[model samples]
Target: MAPLEYLRPSDEGAAIALAEADGRACLLAGGTDVVGLLKDGVLAPSRLVDINALPIAGVEIRDGGLSIGALTRLSDVADHPAVRGRFPALAHAVLAAASPQLRNMATVGGSLLQRTRCGYFRDPVTPCNKRAPGTGCSAIDGEHRLHAILGGSDRCIAVHPSDPAVALLALDAVVRTRGSRKERAIPVDDLYLLPGSTPERETLLEHGELIVAVELPATSFAARSCYLKVRERASFEFALVSAAVALDVRGGVIRTARVALGGVAPRPWRARAAEAVLRGSRMTEATIAAAASAAVRDARPREQNAFKVELVRRVLTRVLATAGAGG
Candidate 1:
């Protein structure tokens, strides 16, 4: 690792100013992913703006919703009483991520802002368009068994590797951020940008913007939701296919539904078509399969990853069934 200037900003305004001044400055939160980038030589920022001193590390209820600080550790958020009680899907998603040690050090914002787990992007020697624009995407022809099936373009096929964001998408969470220009809020689903022509740009955040917090609406779905992650190993592994399902079933009929998928898209994918299929319908094997099919109907899979379409359908079906059963 190269020696870099360390800065401790007293306020968000100062932090934003510093970040704007240095184009290569990287925000230092939990140092989980940033340190990995530093060690791997993928990113060598000229300055490190340590935001750990900022007052952004708590979980609270405000305006009838849950507001989680960006600096809150993943372990803390997962084990939070309100989260586990009201948003079990979010809790389960956070708990299912990485290993215990990594979760302990990973922050909520950092978890969502983590880079793609694609081997080509991580390898500095590889010609990855995400790492360097116009260099070309190697994963399109290389080992892409774990690549995306949806929201992929010719420029890039790398999938977003955030587990919690998938559940947040199902819960319709809102992301709040502060940039040098002003503060703004965006839907959790909208924060991620698809890799169309600009594979280098992964998020909608401006140059000096920093994630402040994420707000989850106080809805019934939060209580009756569950997350299902299918990975190669029992632990310490990214998902091959993950489903987050939230259903509001009443009198043997689903009144409302929220579904999102992970490990199969450039962003945390929300299956609104599947939700539409479930609304006002009774939970049945056939209905679940139909909704699952609708969820992956638009998926564009490559040769090695063609199985992901069916795998996501099965995962969605199983997760929806579990959510309906109040599991």
Candidate 2:
């Protein structure tokens, strides 16, 4: 582990100031992800800025939508009555993450900022474009059982490793950001950048910008929402293929549909084309299959991850059926 100087600030201003002053300062929300990286020597920050006291934790029902604070723990989100009732799909996604202990410590902001789970990115000995700008991506032609199929560039093919991200994408969430000079809101889908030439840059946030909260816009589709995660093991494992779906059925016809996929993309893959196919149509196995088929039409899976395409179809179909049944 690298020698790191730690600082615990009294408020948000101090935290932000410290981050602005030190270019290499790493924010420790829960230390679940950052600590592990530091221990493994993949991330060697000179200073660690503890922002736990910056008042970024809470869950509020606002006039527009649900405003979940960045520091709000995953367990708190999963257990909140408002979240469980209003956004059950988001709750389910939280429930499907790590374990009780980790969830109790993991924060919403940290999860959104979590790095890829690719082995190459974590091990200093391996080559990963995400960790090093000019270094080659080891997963490109190596053991890639869990590489991305969507939003992957030749520079990198690592998958985003968060289940909550899929549900947030389907819910049309927006991220609120605060920096030294200004504040702004960025749509969740727009937050992550594709692995283009700058594969090392994951998010669109500028330097010294802190994620304040995430807004989930109101939608009637929330009434019929579900998140289905299929992993190698039943519990405490990352998804092999996961789907988040929400639909509005009117007079036995699909009025509106919201769909997104995880465990198969560098960013959450929104199934807009599939959603378009389901709109104003009657729910039938053939129609559902067609929509599901459209969702993975552009999937570009590498060698070992080809099986994920079929699993994605099956999982999404099940999610749609459940949402259609209003279960």
Candidate 3:
């Protein structure tokens, strides 16, 4: 571990200014992911800007929607009454992530911004485009069982490791942030960037921009949503494939549908094709199967991860059926 400057900013402005002044300064909220990156030699920042003092650590109901503070613990979000009642999929996704101890320490913002669990990216000795730009991606032809099958570029194939993000994408959540210039509201779909040529840049957030809160809009389908994660083990494991499905069904027919997938793409993949197929369709086995097929129509599965193509389809089919049944 390298010695770095520890900065405790009293206000949001101070924190933003400190981070803007030093390009390599990292914002520390719960220290769940950042600490591990630092210890693993993946991230060596010049300073650590602790933002725990910035009064942004609660879940509030505003404008008939939910506003979750960026610093709110994952456990709190998972256990919040309103979250469980209104956005059950989001609650389930958060609860399915990590472990109870990590949920208590991991912040909502940190979870959204957490790095990929790719073995090559975490190990400095291995060549990874995400960790070192222009370098070869080790997972492209190496141990890539956990890599992406949908949104992988030739340079990188790492999957985004956020369970809550998949649900947020399905719910059309918005992220509010304060940057050096001005405040901005980024939709969950636009928050993450695909691993195109620039695999190192994973998100659209600019340098020194701090996520303040995530706003989930009130929707009829959100309450009927479901998040399903298929992992190697029962608990404390990242998903090999996951699906978040929300449906607004009326008179046994789907009126609106939102489907998002995780652990099979560079970012939380919004399955708009699947949603289009489900709209105005009856919730039957045939409809679910068609939608599932549409979701993976354009998947570019590698040799090692070809199983994820079928796995994601099955997961999406299950989630869609569950959400449709509940609706």
Candidate 4:
């Protein structure tokens, strides 16, 4: 570990300015991910700007939609009545994350901004393009059983590790942020960046930009949604393949559908092709099978992670069925 200064800002602007002034300063919200990185020597910031005192830690109903403060705990969001009743997928995704203790300390913003669990990236001694650009990606030809199959390039192939992010992508959530320049709203789909050549830049967030809240628009499909995660164990483990599905079914046909996959891509992947196959289609085994096949049509699985191609298809089929049944 490295010696660092800690400062708590009285306001959002002050926090952003403090971070912007020092290029190596890092914002600390829940300290779940940032602390771990610091201890592991993955990050050595000159200063830690504590933003826990900021007035941004609650769930609110905003004009028929939902707004979750960035500092809000994952456990609180999971247990919120509005989240459970309206955005079931979001609630389930939070519950399906880390254990109860971690959920209590992990904030919504921290979860979205959490780094990948790729062993190469976490170990400073290893060669990982994400951790140090220009260095080779060890996972490419090494142990990549948990690497990405979709949206991967020769530069890197590490899967993202956030269950709630997948649900947020499916719900079309927008992340609200306040930066050194101005406040802006970014779509959840646009928040992540692929590891094309700059694997070091994981997200689209600008330097010194702080996530304030997440806005989820009220949609008919949001209520009838489901999240399914397949992991090696029942607790304290990351997903091998996961799917979040939202369907608005009228009469017997699907009206609107939202499909997102995790643990098989560098980011929370939106299966637009699968959604296109489901719209106006009857909720049946045949329809789900076709949609599932379409979801993995473009998958470029590696040697060790090739099983993920079939695993994601099965998971998507089950999640879509679950969401459709709820409707």
**Poorly placed runs, candidate 1 (over 4 Å):** none
Better candidate number, 1 or 4, judged by lDDT: 4
* Cα lDDT tens digits for candidate 3, 210-279: 9999999998788898899999998899999999999889999999999999999999999999999999
CA error at residue 109 for candidate 1, angstroms = 0.8
* TM-scores, each model vs. reference: 0.98, 0.98, 0.99, 0.99
Rank by lDDT, descending? 4, 3, 1, 2
- Candidate 4 lDDT, tens digit per residue, 1-327? 999999999899999999998989999988988999999999999999999989999999998989999999999999999999999999999999999999999999989998999999999999889998999999999999999999999999998999999999999999999997889999999999999999899998987899999999998889999899999998788999999999999999999999999999999999999999999999999999999999999999888999999999899878887888883
Structure candidate 4, residue pairs in collision: none
What is the C-alpha lDDT profile of model 2 across 169-251, one tens digit per residue? Answer: 88888999888898989998889888889999989987668898988888878758889999989899988889999888989
Worst 10 residues of 3 by lDDT: 318-327
For all predictions, the C-alpha RMSD in Å is 1.0, 1.0, 0.8, 0.8
Q: Rate the local accuracy (lDDT) of all candidates.
A: 0.92, 0.88, 0.92, 0.93
The runs of at least 3 residues in candidate 3 whose Cα sits more than 4 Å from the true structure, single-residue gaps closed, are: none
Error of 2 at 239 (Å): 0.7
The best candidate by lDDT is 4
How large an RMSD does model 3 have? Answer: 0.8
